[model samples]
Target: MKYHVQVFVSLKPSILDPQGRTVERALSHLGHENVSGVRVGKLVEMVMEGERAAVEAQARALAETVLSNPVMESFRVEVRELAGA
Candidate 1:
């Protein structure tokens, strides 16, 4: 099976995000005053071949230890089977 995996990483709520604050200010200056509490995060996407369960497990483990800093950051993993592949 071929799976599409996505890992979303972001700073924990208690952590202050300077980059997010900067982006929020930039957006406000650009006339997007409705935006608030902007937070920057990372998405890591990958395509892998394996059993669906195994693939999801691997992706979750990768997100847990490799893609995110478990201390100050949190991550979520999404896995879907590829279509027409």
Candidate 2:
């Protein structure tokens, strides 16, 4: 069987994200006063097979190398079983 995984990677809390702050400021300036503390992140989804451990390792490697920056970001992976190929 194959599984689908969703990986979410976000900037570390200690890191300063000017892009996110700019977006938040723009929102407030545009009259979205209720919007607060917006943070930017990345999402990656893929399908793979094999033991859970192996699949998770593969996903993490991809996340660390291609999808996220280890210096300033953290990532998490969510796996779901699929019924079809």
TM-scores, all candidates, are 0.95, 0.84
lDDT by residue for model 2 (14-55), tens: 998888999999999999999987898888888889888888
lDDT of each residue in 38-80, candidate 1, tens digit only? 9999999999899988898899889998999999999999998
Which number leads on lDDT? 1
Cα lDDT, all candidates: 0.93, 0.89
User: Ten-residue segment with the worst summed lDDT in candidate 1?
Assistant: 76-85
Error of 1 at 3 (Å): 0.4
Q: Which stretches of candidate 2 lie over 4 Å from their true place?
A: none
lDDT of the structure predicted as candidate 1: 0.93
Model 2 / residue 14 / CA error / Å? 1.0
Q: Relative to the unseen true structure, what is the C-alpha lDDT of residue 12 in candidate 1, on a scale of 0 to 100? A: 100
